[model samples]
Target: MTFSIKDDSPLVSVITPSYNCSAYIKETIDTVLDQSYPNWEMIIVDDHSQDDSVQVIQSYEAMDSRIRLIPLANNVGAARARNIAIKEARGDYIAFLDSDDLWLPTKLDEQVEFMKSGNLAFSFTSYSLIDEQGHSLAIEVKAPQTVDYKHLIGNTTIGCLTVMLDRKQIKHIEMPDIQPEDTALWLSLLRNGYQAHGLPKILSKYRIVSNSTSRNKWKAAYRYWKLLRVQEKLNIVEANFYFTKYAYNAYNKSRGLQPVSIQNGGK
Candidate 1:
């Protein structure tokens, strides 16, 4: 219950990739500013946005030294942008947030306390989905208590915005250049005998932008299948099995139905 642990060092470093999200990045940054947790720095890497997002980010950076901006010379994808921030992060804990997404006021404080109290290396939380204009979709995805590699392979329940990782535990900290880079990195770690602790608290908000890459359902499914085969090197039968479960969970979330919980252990 006591989130007032010591703040001797920068406890959390937030990594966010910004593109053409000038309209929403302000709100996204504002959420961090409002967090009850004070010992944190935000590392935002702008992926060569054409819009005035750089100006918006700069204004905030000037206001607070904790908010730093890394403007890219050329347009790299989100994976590379996030990797850049990861390389430069100086905090003990690393967290991810997209320019269009948001976090609750106590997100950093509560999650940090949970990880520290339980001695958890990696953790994620449930989140609420919001429409493009910041309207809630009226659905909250509840995270299971814990998810090992097997459960995560079938159910992609860990939102990137809700993740917090211990820097010391992560031997490597770069994300692969894949469609779902966040999931890919999580899988890589989980596969190496690491379990991602899930906090059932809804501490973040994920925005459903109409024009994002995930809008095309069929393409997204195919990309996920490819990720399993190419990244995980899974056989046809194994890929099909996990893909089926992934599809089912995706369907459940799309319809506002909760994804089935993993029991004391996964299936």
Candidate 2:
């Protein structure tokens, strides 16, 4: 069913956690500014950035009332920064977009309708990967139409940038202060019997930064292992089983197996 967003659409609060992302933050903000859905507030929480990121974001905040900036006193990690923005969110829906990523113009418009049509609490859309230069790598990670806890434990198909959550359904939202915090949050929601439905549209671009912790394979693997053992409390055998599946998916996502049309500037 086709749905058109109206002028009186429910407000969406975009949560953005920023660190030293001055280089790509402007582009990220531009994508949100270009969104077809205008009823949204982008709350950018800067984690004590040493660079000019705070100044850059504050400039936009001054121009638009919907764009807000919260500069932290200390350099908290992304997990904490995100939580701060979450606390300040005053919208019916919540969306996450990292400072380095980009979103399609129709992302929020289409995703809001997708959630409403199914009465979904949590939902995510397909997203493509791009280089730090914002050039599409022709690698896209597709999302299944629906995912439950059983299927999600072995697969990290959801991307933070493409996620949209209905605040009305989820009364309390929080993320553990740990590596792979987004994954932990997803698992928690799914474990509570909340099914995450996906709109299979490439609505966002996840930028692969060279210096990002995700680029370090061993570290990333260790983080996932810890999440499984400590947070999920899975036994050794079960941990290894799920870890293998997660690793396999991560490997495929790194390659061009799920290839899409290559575009410049994350178009």
Scored by lDDT, the top model is 1
* lDDT per residue (tens digit) for residues 133-236 in model 2: 98889988888888877677777688999999999999988889778999999988998879999899899999999999989999999999999888888888
For residue 188, model 1's alpha carbon misses the true position, in angstroms, by: 0.5
Q: For every model shown, what is its TM-score relative to the native structure? A: 0.94, 0.93
**Candidate that scores best on TM-score:** 1
- lDDT tens digits, residues 176-258, model 1? 99878999999989988889998999999999988888878888898899999899888888888888888999888877787
Worst 10 residues of 1 by lDDT: 1-10
Question: Model 1 has how many clashing residue pairs?
Answer: 0
| Model 1's TM-score against the true structure | 0.94
Runs with alpha carbons beyond 4 Å of true place in candidate 2: 1-7, 258-267
